[model samples]
Target: MDKIRNFCIIAHIDHGKSTLADRLLEHTQTVADRDMQDQLLDSMDLERERGITIKSHAIQMNYRNGGDEYVLNLIDTPGHVDFSYEVSRSIAACEGALLIVDASQGIEAQTISNLYLAMENDLTIIPVLNKIDLPGASPEEVSDEIVDLLGVERDEIIRASGKTGQGVDDILDAIVKRIPAPKGDPEAPLQAMIFDSQYNPFRGVEVIFRVFNGTFKKGDAVKFVNTGRTYNADEIGILKLEQEPQKEIAAGNVGYLISGIKNAREVKVGDTITHVERPCEAVTGFEDVKPMVFAGIYPVDTTEYEELRASMEKLQLNDASLVWEPETSAALGFGFRCGFLGMLHLEIIQERLEREFDMTVITTVPSVQYKAVMTDESIKWVNAPSEMPEPNKCSHIEEPYIKAQIISKSDYIGPIISLCMDKRGILKNQVYLTTDRVELTFDLPLAEIVFDFFDKLKTISRGYASLDYELTGFRQSNMVKLDMMLNGEKVDALSAIVHRDKAYEWGKRLCEKLKELLPRQMFEIAVQASIGTKIIARETVKAMRKNVLAKCYGGDISRKRKLLEKQKKGKKRMRQVGNVEIPQEAFMAVLKLD
Candidate 1:
């Protein structure tokens, strides 16, 4: 136990956490140079392409110096706010965390949030200043900021360049010296924390856990504390680049357990695994992850409903945070209403379903849960506009709000604040990080930012602004559900939540955008936006009339004129009763308004 060190690397996205992990992986010779890949901890291609970590990955390493040998268990976690749950689970598995801050960008919105998270977990945090090799690298300036933020001495902070392998040895030494060894009693009954899991087609459910006490052998029958279920361990092993089987995983060690259970629901992250014969009490566990964003996912072809369900179940095996249920939409055929941690999480699942499962899906506009106070003194929580109670039936509606922190240049503060104000954001505070860069904090509505806030914030700040947000609570507001109607038919997918004051402008703009996107029809199509009984804006799509005079002969001009008049009359009659076929893209036009 004294020779083991379990730790994780935490940082803001693009702040070089993965790069630092790469340098450390090579420094310890965990994997050889030929086999090593850049940002090796990011196992998914999507993660590398997006330049961010979406999932947490773990690896065990063996290091030797002089006469001392050490076991280091390193976990790399996603830095984005959407994956905060993953970060928490990663932190829980480790005794310490390495806080990596970029020398150029310094601390960011996510940096502060991650700092608080580390503090909450009571883990030893080693502050490391990374990317000293960059041209604009300012170690002194960023060092001062870290000192101010973390109250750590300048000398205590280690300076390293992940790209050049500088200070790699010093960091490894600090881990052995600073991070205390994992503490547990090998004689105690079995106890372990399941930090991560995966569904293996060949091996059943493989779970990554840290042994808190006792010993686990290959054939031990372990019981899950949360579910009260027992499974015979088919195999036990440790992960480096791949699984290496072991005779036993001792106390205070991190490894994998091949729980020979085909069903994913039998095990879960944050659940405790104990020996069935001599089980110990479960440790205080993590809080349940509540999804903040909701969306309706319907199959492009409804006949593939069962296939979609199976695909979702497979995905849920790995992503326990995902929650979904069978739902039927009047317009979208059969589908499921899925909940996600945030917008990024929702997008990732949608993309993976389409690409990995070979199923085409139509996702509705994302929504936030709103609390409604009914006229009968009752309260209800709604996730979709269709679930909202009638305006007359409610005394008031309360929408979810978020505490958003932004970091950007001072020159762009004016426009950034203006954008926030437009989104019904209340400025809470602002502080100068540097002479040029500033941090702005606001309390904004969750619905406001769920759609296009991040993209718009980037545009407003000229791609220099970064954002972090968390749901604060619900606040009473004058909210309305704006609906769009095409040819007197309500398109449920085009509904949105908006403040009443912006209803006219929002309605007018949506109608205009829809008019440009919807194809011309055989008859006139009326695109109208409304709130309850009031029509706020309307756009008329003229009938696409066929020329009645195209086949007319040179003679009998009067006959051709009569044919044109008849055609006009027929078009006018058809315009009154014919249905307009709006394409799928038209229903998604509101998403482009950003």
Candidate 2:
């Protein structure tokens, strides 16, 4: 046990957390000469493509120095703020965290946030200043800032260029000295914390956990403490950070367990697994994560709804963070309104679902929570535009707001400030980092920042801006819920929360975008935007001309007749708005800007 060390590396997004993991694996000779691959811990194709760690990965490494062998249990954690909850769970499984800070860029907002979480977990932190090989590297200055900001001893900062393998030895040495080995009763009942899990077709549910008490082996009957579900471990293997697996993972080790259990919900994160003969209490922090953003997710083809549902279920089995419920929208025949941690998380899940399941999806406009006061003095939470109380029935409405902190270059400050002001942002404070950089904080509506705000900020700052935000509770303000009506019926998926003054402008923009993306129909399509009882803008899509006449040949009147019959059937399938088949594309068009 004295030779074992369990730790995770935490850093801001794009701060080289994954890169550092790769370097460490190489430095420790964990991977053979021919088995070299970049970002080894990032095994998933989606993770590599997005250049982000979507899931936490654990791998074991054997490092030898002076004829002494040390087993390093390295866990790679997601750096994005949206997946902070997962990061915390990963931290809880480890005894320490390597706080990697970019030497060129001092501690950013996310760096501070992750650091605070690690501190709260009572994990020993080893501050490492990374990226020292960059041209703007300032390890010494960052070291000083670490001492002042984190209240750590200046000598505690380890400087290393994860890219060039400089000072990596010292970092590993520090980890060996600082991180404590696992302390548990190895002779007691078998118990482990399921920190993470994965689903394999061949293995069913592959649970990755750290044994805290007794040893577990293949064919052991274990019961999940929370769910009380029992499973016979068919296979138990140790991860060597390689393709091949090792046998017999004992207490004080991190590895995988292949149980015959097919249900993913039964084996949850933070749940304790104990030998059925000797039960144990479950670990804390297994609460289900509540999603903050909700959006309608529909298949491109209505016929694929069942297939999409099955695919989502399989995906959810591995990723318990994703929440979904069956929902039906009048405009979008049948679909699921899914909830996510944030925009990036939503995008990642969408991309993964499409890539892994081979399904085309149309998503609706994302929305934040809204507090509505009904005529009878009843308060309710509104997540969809269709769910908004009737105008006359609503007495008051409030939307969620956020406190945002933005860091950017000085020359772009004017444009950043202008953008913020245009989004109904209230400036709270601003400070100059240097002659050419500034940090600004503002109180902005959550709805405003939820969509394309980060993209706009990057464009305005020439891709030099860094922004971070946290929910600052709902506030009473002048706001209106705008609804989009196709023909005469309302589309709940097309609703939005906008300031009273900007409702007309938003409505006009949405109407035009929808007009361009919606396919031509047999009858005029009406796109109307309304605020309560008032209509702000409207557009009409003229009838489309059938092009079948030009293609009829080879005595294919049967084909032509079939085409006409199919078109008639399509027309019949569509919701009649005057006389038109409003394609699913039309509903999807409202979700995005042109």
Candidate 3:
């Protein structure tokens, strides 16, 4: 147990966390040269293409120092704020964290937040200045920032370049020396916490867990404390680049268990796995994930509803943070109301569903969960715009608020502040971390940042700003459900709840966007945005005329008028029965209507 050091790498996005991890793997010889690759821990194709870690990956490394050998369990965590849940799960299973900061970029918002998270969990933090290979690398300045942030000695901060494999040995040495070994009793009854999981179609659900006590042997009957379900472990193994099968994995070790459990829902992340016969007290698990954005995900072909559900369940096993329940929409038919960490999270899930499961889905306009207080003083939760109660019935509405932390250079502070202000963000505090780097805090509606806010911030700051946010609780706001109507009928999928002050303008923009996206039909399509019965904005897509008067080229004025009247009557009838088939892009257009 003393030789087993479990740790994770935490950093802001694109801070060389994965690259540093690859070097560590190489230095330790955990992965052979023939098998080596950049971001080696990031196994998914999506992760590699996007140059982001969407999931936390754990692998065991064997390090030899002097005559002794040590086992290192390293979890490479995602750096994006949307995948912070992945980082938290990794943190929960580890005893320490490698806080990697970009030498040139210094410290950013996500770095500070992730560090706080590790600190909260009592994990030892080893600060490392990465990306020193860059021409702009400023190790001295970044080291000072690290010292001020972590209060660590100057020499304690290791300067490393992941690209050139510099200081990789020092990082390994630090992990062995600084991070404490896991503490658990082998004699105690089995108590293991499942930190992460992945779906295997041929082999059933594979559970990756850390053993806190006792031993997990092949063929041991294990019970999930949360679900009260028991299954025989068909195979038990330690994780390497591949699963190294083992007869048993003892306490203080991380390993995988394949129980031949076909159902994904049966296995839950953060659930405690114990021996069914001699079970120890259930271990405490990680906190439940709080989903920040809600959207309805429906099958493009409605007949594939059940298949989509299965795909979602399997996906949920891999991504435990995804939350969903069955829902039906007037336009989209039956679907699941899925909740995600943020817009990026939502988009990734949608893309993965398409790529991995071969299930094409249409996602509705995303919305934040709202609190609607009734006149009788009862509060109702609204996850969709369609769920919002009438203004007459509700006393007031409260939208989810977030404490947003944005770190950026001083030169862009003015534009950053204005951008946040445009999103109805109230500046709460601002501090100069240094002469050039500034950290600003704002209290903003979660819905305000749901769409284009991050993109706009990146544009305004010229990609220099980093943002991290946490829910601050619900606050009273003058918000209304803005409904989009096509051909006089409301499309529930097109509706969104917006602040009252911006509803008219938002409605106008939305109507214009739909006008551009919706295909023209035989009849004039009236695109209207409404609040209750009041139409706030409207746009018209003119009907496609067939030149009905071509056959009567020299007709009298009265005859022309008669033919025109006939054509008008036909248009009115077509408009009544016409169902505007909203193209998929229209649903996403609401996000870019600005």
Give each model's whole-structure lDDT. Answer: 0.88, 0.81, 0.93
TM-score list, all predictions: 0.95, 0.89, 0.99
| Deviation (Å) of 403 in candidate 3 | 0.7
Number of the top-ranking candidate, with TM-score as the measure: 3
**So what's the TM-score on candidate 3?**
0.99
Best by lDDT: 3
lDDT ranking, best first: 3, 1, 2
Q: Which stretches of candidate 2 lie over 4 Å from their true place?
A: 242-248, 431-438, 543-591
Q: Comparing candidate 2 with candidate 3, which one achieves the higher TM-score?
A: 3
lDDT of 2: 0.81
Compose the digit string of candidate 2's lDDT tens values, residues 1-594.
888899999998888888888888888988886887778888889888878888888888888856789999998888887888788878888889999999987777677778888888788899999999999987777787688667888888888887898888998899888999878877888889988887777767788889988888778888988888888887888777543455556778888888776765576677898999988766675456767788889887899999999888778766767888888887667889888888888888888888888998888888877899778989988877767776788888888888898878789988999999988999999987656667899999988877778889889888778787777788876778888877767767677877899889889988887787777766567888998878999987665646765677677568778878877666545536354345556655655563
Q: Decide which is better by TM-score, 1 or 2.
A: 1
Candidate number that wins on lDDT, 2 or 3: 3
Worst 10 residues of 3 by lDDT: 277-286
